[model samples]
Target: MAKPWFRVKRFGYGAGLPCAWQGWVVLAAHLALLIAASALLTGRPLPLSIVVITSTLGVVWIAWKTSDAPWRWRDGGED
Candidate 1:
């Protein structure tokens, strides 16, 4: 029989590695900020323009910096 807490612990949200998760989290935060900035600046719904520009820059930055392969990346899936 498996312990109840074990299941909960193993199945916890965002089971991936910390470093990998950190990168994703940072990216998400940056995107959200840009989206919010656009919405606030443009005073329009969705704010896709800022999202696009911010996304482009974010992606490029990640892609270039991550190419070294030294960056710690958490697994997308739980162990």
Candidate 2:
């Protein structure tokens, strides 16, 4: 059987935060860069795109932590 999307994201964690705020900071920066660049290049509504992407990453992080697969180091998929 194929691995589910949640399994593929198991390695998403890199830092251990003291609280949810810190965790969100890490996720926010990663997402902000992506959303900002995409918005600029595509001529989309920048602020709205940032907010939506940031929210989406937060939810994805939540689901990822709650999923059955164990947490693996976020190595950026590098060796």
Candidate 3:
């Protein structure tokens, strides 16, 4: 299998910072999308909301799929 782009957080219940260039690219793209959407969809509340929500879910999905391990509560202990 391919190496994961994100690593599980050591003290939380989710993925942490990017562990690969691909992950960084994904994060940057997501941010750019949100910014562009907000700027372009201003004054259109419905469309803005849709774009934000969809983009958020899409990013979460990508992180989960590319994470080094499944997300779960962590106490900073060795697995």
Candidate 4:
């Protein structure tokens, strides 16, 4: 029997969002942490933004490379 659409797996995870809801949620939390950590470490906003943006971009790139679907979409077949 075939698996249900929602139960299909992709991108090393059970696919949801293009980047996966799991990745977006994790990235959001990581950004929040980066904000706090950079602020505490540098006592400045510029470095905080820079670090957060860089890290966020890196994560986004990784998510994009690992995902098989387009942004905001999902696929059921392995790619």
What's the TM-score of each model vs. the native? 0.38, 0.33, 0.94, 0.43
* 1-79: candidate 3 lDDT, tens digit per residue: 4899999999979999999999999999999998999899889999999998998899889999999998999999998
Q: How displaced is residue 79 in candidate 4, in Å?
A: 14
Lowest summed-lDDT stretch of 10 residues in model 2?
A: 1-10
Clashing pairs in 2: none
Which model is ahead, 3 or 4, in terms of TM-score? 3
Better of 2 and 3 by lDDT: 3
lDDT of 3 at 41: 89
User: For model 4, how does the per-residue alpha-carbon lDDT over 1-79 read when each residue is reduced to its tens digit?
Assistant: 1221122244344334433465666667776888677768686777777777777777666565554444442344544
Best candidate per TM-score, number?
A: 3
- Write out the backbone clash pairs for model 1: 20-74
Q: Highest lDDT among the candidates is held by which one?
A: 3
What residue pairs are clashing in model 3? Answer: none
Q: In each prediction, how many residue pairs overlap at the backbone (N, C-alpha, C within less than 3 A)?
A: 1, 0, 0, 0
- State the TM-score for model 2: 0.33
lDDT of 2 by residue, 16-69 (tens): 432444445655765776667776657556766776677767756764654434
Q: For residues 1-79, what per-residue lDDT tens digits would candidate 1 score against the true structure?
A: 1111111113333222224554566567777887677767675545666566767787656544443232343444543
